[model samples]
Target: MIDSGESAVSDSILFVTHSPQRSGAESVMLDLAAECHRRGMSVSVACPVGPLSESFPPWAVHVEIPHLGRDHGRRTRAGAAWGMARSMVVAARTLRAHRGTAIVANSAHTLPALRLAGVRSVAWLVHDHLVSRKTRVFIGAGRPLLHHVVAVSPTTASALDGLVDHVAVGRLGVDIPDDAPTGALPTGPLRAGTLSVLTPWKGVDVFLEAVARLDDATAVVAGEAFPGDVGYAAQLRERAGHPDLAGRVTFPGRVRAADALAQWTVHVSASIAPEAGPLTAMEAMAAGVPVVATDHGNPRNLLADRRGVLVPPGDPVALADAMSSIAADPHGTAAMVRRAYAHVAEHHDRRETVPALLDLLLGTTSSSAPAAPADAVAAPSRGGGGSR
Candidate 1:
């Protein structure tokens, strides 16, 4: 429990994010903010003016910090740094205004600003793999300023091994819809789809190629592109018009995950780069939608134990085969769906993860709280059925 003397400040939490886009990390913070508001905590989000700002709960405060990292137009390295510096100025001022409120830096991009603010109660919630040397160096430089560091998955925690210490694994969770079709497979022709920002690294093209191999199955690539990736998005749109995939693939722009998943017979995560913990795949698992993800990063662990299927990254043939197998083996697929639902319910329920995160933000802990164990941060069990 929080100390009585610090209750006043501890009850207020300010979340600082780098992107205005409602991606996985932003969605997590939004959900957390809503939960905090429901619990009568003072919640404020400091981010740039964009789609994310419009989604905050009515009671929560929205502090608009212009040009905060992600949305800044293309610029030189020095220019980007200068923009971040300006954003940090505003961020520091916001921190000073809030005074003792606990702070959650929702992205590594916010770390430098948090360091500049020099607040004591700060938690850096890391969501990326930090594979780039530049990103690793950037995050490592401000690590000492963080009071607590939380990673969304063990793979993510492992990536930060030497860069930061005492890293806690905080797996992303989703609300299992009351109508989630557990143990029930979708009927009719196969409809494989993926829900993520249409970036090259996400391997949306690979998913399209896999869907092309299917004779009559349709596909939905449901997301918009980031500003910097507009060219890639255009390329994807053009590819969708190619001979093989012409009318089979549909780009529905941006969509709610549930809306998209409801239409998908199978959900795919075909990222060329290793994902930390993709919320879309987790949501699919929780909703009893069979997942076929690349056998690397968090997905390898996520889909392990026959809970879902795993395919090699960028392998269209393997991905296509996995989708076809789901339709061919309905009984097996349903069983996998059931196991996935059970796994998500037991391990990734937001009821458990949110409070655990809240405890970190509130500077409180209890025996039952989901704190990291001594040897390593806790992750979902990886042993069970063999990989398909």
Candidate 2:
């Protein structure tokens, strides 16, 4: 949507991502974009054509871009380099065509595009504390088109401590219910579950192993690998097929967001790697499900209160103990659920946090209070270094 004769009131925000997959990071981006649309700010998303793109609403503009392969083999790396360069130029050209549209680089893959755009885009970092050397260099260089870098987790913010000029923790927003039924637990056997992308680092194996140790609870896992990650998913299937896990572990491939969490008695997040911003965990807490997450990454920060329990990362025995403890104490679990609902409402509610995010982007200029223009109060103004 363009500014018709300079009378447009809405600000335009263009979101860029590497893949359209519904991963944790992408979910956060989509949530913010959807919230922006709700707030009457014109929103659009640019990503590779896939299932994840379908999640975007009909009202927002959709831009399909090339998929740059990863840095694995030499051939793939070369191809990715070429594709990344081309994609960056294409993204810059697309933005150049549409004036006054702020850019939000949803992934590190969009770094090249932000560099080319010249200090007009914000780097939305959701990937963990491990910032790649190349990405760090790209961010370290004071590119004119690049805006300040904002991360979804404090761990991520701390990891990138000195590399960037500006860093802020853009907390992921969750929708908390006005009221929740306390002491009303799900019927039948307790279910221990986790929502994650089907990668080894996500610790699905650990979750399955933990489930195998317990008898009273069924294990429900939700996730699927990317298009070409068949081997990885197949290995996970092999793990689920173990004799101890027979009829106990169920991998419902890529169910709707929060579907697994809502049904389960106690939600689990067993990521071995340092998590950035976990949308499923946030959604589960918002839904009043008691969470048992790894004591690492964003979960460690979110589960500061007695809302949920935490275990050592990658330890199946510890996870099993946590799950067992929660299952045994029904009253305690119910109380924890209430605390979780309150915690999410106080920190992550959308009615408050969504506008705060918009302010973060709009206030990225040299001036502390970069006010939206009179006509574009519905959206952000076309100020310098306005985030994408």
Candidate 3:
């Protein structure tokens, strides 16, 4: 562990982000950077810089490279690979210049270069499942190069069997003001469903299908298209006006970063594919709002038997029923709010998570695995039985 008392910091950590864009991964990195800074570590972030330049910390130095963007297809994939190699070379040179600190490689694209840079201690933070074959290959190449692989969830950790030497599960922390509104009961007919990026995996279409089934409450969707997702977003907007869904749906485009987590009554993370760990659900729980979500990815682990309702993915009937249950019972909503706040307070609180994560990064802990105590239950996927 690097010293952290009332001493001057000799170590620095370089955070490499592939997409400087304000998605969940970037948000997690920002929290980690802020936490590191608070703990007296010299910190900086490097990215293939663009519009996201404004999103960095004022005090920390920013490094820019030409290789990163929001592209995901085959041709762009080859470009990203080449760009990563060049960026890695530059990163290695920079690390040598800085000397004493560790490197926190936050993206799949930056791992190989960090390895080549020969930093004795390098930690790779993995935020999602290596779903595609290409992702698996990228991760596989970086396996031996990383000192530790930090997975955001247990399921994600389980997926990386031979990729990394050590694996740790670090859940994201949710920090909301103590004086923020609490004990909130659903008082209006307006219900909100949010996922900041409109994509197939996020189940935006599935959410709209559920909205078509709801008659009592208005469903507001918050998100916009990324570079290649404009067509999908347009189709969703068009379908929002089906005969059954016409009056109930509202597409609010994109929710601003500052207000994304705070403006909704109920947050819905309607993911069809298993996501790594969804911050929106955690944010909703922190805001004392109940959530209705599909049992895909980390929500099953996060919500368990408290604070939210889980339904089978792509099942509009089940989703509609779950939404109705939340909308019809105001008392239930209040209880869920209490449970949500309590759940996040006990597990996802910054005070608890940040320290644990620091310990892992510093090599003070033997197991990076998340502890599932008796009070905490694991969330399951679509067909898995609910935990009581």
Leading candidate by lDDT: 1
Model 1 Cα shift for residue 139 (angstroms):
2.4
What lDDT tens digits, residue by residue, belong to model 1 across residues 78-169? 87767667877787776667546777888877766666776655677878875476566457656655567777888877776656646667
Per-residue lDDT tens digits of candidate 3, residues 1-388? 1332222224567777666566888777777777678768777787766545577768677876444333555377678666556666776665555335656667776655555665555677778765456566555655554555677777676566554555766676767547544556546664767755887778888878877776766677777777668888888988987787777778777675336555556677788888776777777787777788888677777777666899998887888788777767778777777877777776777666666665555555425335533233324222212111
Residue range 1-388, candidate 2, lDDT tens digits: 2221222233777777876576767766777787678767788887777787887778878887765435333366667677667766876565455445766767666666655555344535445567677665544442344454566657776666555545666666677778764745688887887878888778888888898888767888787887566677888789878888777888888786556666888888898887875767778888878889999877777787677899999899999999888878999888888877777776777666566655554443223232321111221222333222
Q: What lDDT is obtained when candidate 2 is compared to the true structure? A: 0.68
RMSD of each: 5.6, 6.7, 6.2
Worst ten-residue run, lDDT, model 3?
A: 379-388
Which candidate order results from sorting by TM-score in descending order? 1, 2, 3
Error of 3 at 327 (Å): 1.3
Worst 10 residues of 2 by lDDT: 373-382
What candidate 2 gets wrong by more than 4 Å, as runs, is: 1-10, 69-83, 86-100, 117-127, 141-143, 364-388
Residue pairs in candidate 2 whose N, alpha carbon or C atoms collide under 3 angstroms: 20-52, 103-388, 104-388, 118-144, 118-145, 119-144, 119-145, 119-146, 120-145
- CA lDDT of each candidate? 0.77, 0.68, 0.67
Model 3 TM-score relative to the real fold: 0.82
**Best-performing candidate as measured by TM-score:** 1
